[model samples]
Target: MTARKKGPPTGGSGANAGAPDTLEGLFPRFPGTKDIRYHPVFQGGLSRWVWRYYTHRLTRAGRWFLGLTCLLGLVGSTSLEIQTYIPFLYAFAFWTVAGAAAAFSRPRVAFVARHADRVCAGETLPVEIEIEQRGRLGGADLNVLPSGLPIPVDAIPEGGVPVPPLRRGEKARVRLGLLCRRRGVYVLRGYRVETDFPLGLLNAYRVFGEERSLLVYPPFHRLARMEMPTGRRFHAGGVALASLLGDSFEFLGNREYREGDNVRDIDWRATARLDTPILREYREEFFLRVAVVLDTHVPRGGRRDEREARRAALERAISVCAGITDYIARQEYIVDLFAAGPNLYHLTAGRSLAYLDQILDILACVEENPDEPFAVIEPQIDERLAQINSVVCVFLDWDETRRAFVENLRRGGAGVKVVLVRDAPPTLDPSGDERAGAIPVIGRADFERGVEEL
Candidate 1:
């Protein structure tokens, strides 16, 4: 939830007549038709004082000019004494003070904003702001100043009148652009709204209270070229007839419908004479399932640089997972994903894009943790192997431990392929140099080629 701010309710009609002498006195005596709240934000103490001093100097200089002119006239006057010029000097000083006061008297303005702190990495979203005038503003212009951004700048100032006359009881809107670069939670800072109207000398700014952060998930790269073992394909609510001839996993029989037989499936002619409902039996065949494995351990490639490299590796893994999920889902396979690192994330088998999106989000939040070894987590994965027919493993490099695990799965009758992302060399060396067999090893530079090979 965001907090609400109140600003001065009234604004200027055109100029002079109704302008408030000062911000403090501009408070609406009786609340106008619209309610205004004051959200007072003082610029830096030193800065504000400096600005005040600068305005005072300008006023003094105007007064000095008027005094010098009056003195010259008094010296030139032959009939009137110098004392007569005193009244004229006083009037000139008053006008000088009025001019400076009007220039410095800024309207009290408040800015309210709301933002979504977190979005999927690579997605663009809008940030909204509402601004209201406080007192009778002589005139004002509102702008959302640009600042450093992590994501791509989309549309900023979500389309408001480029320049709107902020009148009493009136409000204006503004928006900004944002783009997500990569996965990770980021704190939003330096978002400021400023106004420099009436007098461009001073820029009045206010910070929106909608202080929030964004959590961006990593981009899921497309893995359309992943190697997959062919399996049964079924239409929604339809059973495969070929698998039903003794090879199907389940056996169902024709039965007489009690009360609700699908009208389309009912034997209408038979029912018309005997008034009995009959429906055809469906022999359902289960399709093969594939599990996606992401090795989240701090590998040799990951340890290249302490923090940045590890972060990059995790991002790559998440992106690969997204691509894998998309590719497998397109082929109509039940795809599941499992990650082992500081913590373990397991996504159950599903073909829906929504489910895959959830998996991608999990991948976005994944990070390296110095906990449970890969071998220890292997048993946890083994428990779910019955439902999975094949495994597609995504890892940074190929090593003995990974090879042993792949061999274990292959010997257990599971079709396994290792998709090693060789951005860097493996930390462990090969003992018995066995030429690569079925699984393909891919390098980072050859990612495009790997996609085709897979």
Candidate 2:
């Protein structure tokens, strides 16, 4: 016989020999049946029913009773015993009675709320609400709960802000302290007025719709001193020319009048003394204009933990930028903020022209951009590079893109200061290009503990 043909190994030395063939592998295009229990139609209905039962119909005691009823029903169904069915039926009847009582016990009320337009993060926001009973029946055991705030339940009182029993047409005012966790613009959607009466097996609540907005500014350390590159460029009309149009000039010595010279500049005394037309020469005002370029670009596509770390780094960078702006605001320099997030942001504040609060407002709304932001930011800065004396760049990473951006700024004759915000010590040398100068790396831990000076 011819030499036996070699065959593939059945159980060894083959990639798929020992692997079990799965149905998914055999039919890659298989459209498997979805679990009906988890379908949106079922899930949404179930969740809504559960929420309504818990919030509107069920109380703490009712939940325990319901659980016991469910256990009894399961046992009765399995054993088909009359004795087991009796307890389940009794529990079910009690639940039905409790729910009916709660449904009719809902408090009919109207309310109004007032709060500040803005609050700093990590601070307690006080919301003042005035509730009035509208129904013929008096409202009792009322709880005022603010809705649409990202506040923890533990932060608020267990039963919410309790209001004493109110007679018909009576009103009560209560203050609710909302704990702000992070910085962002938030809207207070409404307030829920809830009460549990009678059997205390359910809570009857009515939601009052009230739309209000609140801005939360990021919390930042107050820097005692911040070292920035020393530079001042000539401002044609100083703060007036930079912001508005007005007179901002310094008087120099007297000189002969020119044809285009303003008649107002003619020095009558000098002209009289010299017996010739002489004019007072003035120079344009000069001041420091620093650009605080905040890097809000967060790379996309990473593990959950990695994405979180990147976000944390971005927040730290924001805090650093806030601190720098705070320090610059105290000085006499004109500060311009350049941040590239979802959109490009540019704000000018300083010399009493604008308040620091405006800068904080911009920072509050800044979001993370996944794409490289330097491309958009470079063009923005280039347009005003001639006016900007120094640039304070707050970057999350010191990668090639950022390095190139900074290098370009230095080439454009801007005094640049780089601040790298990272959780760990930086691995890449930020000073690889001497033209960018030495960069200061600020660790997240140090920032959290507080950096008094930068």
Candidate 3:
């Protein structure tokens, strides 16, 4: 369990001021929110000191300026160098020492922050940084930008975020923005605080925060505008003569009144006629079991680049799995997702608000496994095949083995739908699992359109 972070500090020192207001809270608390992570600190060693303080990444202009300083020093070392050049050497030396000295000072302000890091892919998240310092911040001398970000300009600060004046104790706040590009867990090492006080030539920065993690979940998509087909009842119970055939909720026949039975639902007429307590007996209801299988296996023995590409393709498949789970659960079915990761998992995704959150949390961190075989989940699927009304199969590759697997589900009496994701090429050869056969096969890229056609 994770501690639910409260709304961004109302005082304007936190990220999103409140919880995410998205589509009906369809989002989950991103994958990782447990534990505090530390950022790298300087050790007392010559190499560490020189690397952390004396040197820094030079801005374009800073690079040229430093090169010029070096050239001047070289000329001064020669006795034969002109006297006019000697003035240039002294001027450069003065600026370097002064700029370095001003920026090299440790930050007087202490910072603390709160971030709403959990977000769906492609959504913007807010961040708030609050500053507490014993001395006033002087102008822009104590500049604050989120460090360790590839693009520092993206973190937007909140309005009225005072850049505290120097030498006076004060408080300050800054808000930032984050863009999550993919579905997975990301750890933020910490924000970098840098200052170019006396000269912009050398911007000295220090790492000043603990690490934070963000979990980005797969984006949800509606399969189609049409309604999902509820299956014929595969279990006992329920008055749903039609739904009893196979769907989420079913009505069962009345039974003898029980202590726990809702008093309101008691059948008065039956009680009066029999002169005894009788309750409306309904069958134990269960939803059409939606078995969603995500094939995360990537062929082994490929180069690093090739394997990376395969992983990307598999990620798309995972997104498709998320989409299908969302669609089925929204339709009010019990979605059983059999996905392979570090260990094979069988997740029961339900329509209840709490269960939906749980489902997305696990999916957010699932990784692809190349060593695991696709056949591993087949037996589990077979075990529950009798109850499953429909089978949605998502795969990374296509071969005789997988084709036979889909055929097995169909043969077991479950409605079969195949999603051949981007990684696998279509098999045109005429066979039971081919496009020419009875089973419906759709490419991952065209999943939405395929569902519409279905």
Q: Which candidate's lDDT is highest?
A: 2
lDDT of 3: 0.58
lDDT of 1 at 225: 68
Minimal lDDT window, size 10, model 3:
30-39
Ranking by lDDT: 2, 3, 1
Which scores higher on lDDT, 2 or 3?
2
Candidate 2 Cα misplacement greater than 4 A, ranges: 1-45, 74-90, 148-155, 238-284, 302-304, 425-427, 431-433
lDDT of 3 at 262: 89
Q: Least lDDT summed over 10 consecutive residues: which range in candidate 1?
A: 30-39
lDDT of 1 by residue, 398-442 (tens): 677777877777665567766665555655443243433454545
Give model 3's clash tally: 29
Assess candidate 2 and give its TM-score to the true structure.
0.77
My TM-score estimates for the predictions, one after another, are: 0.61, 0.77, 0.70
Residue 191 miss distance in model 1 (angstroms): 4.5
* Model 1 / residue 246 / CA error / Å: 25
Give lDDT tens digits, candidate 2, residues 35-74: 1222223247776455445544566677787789999998
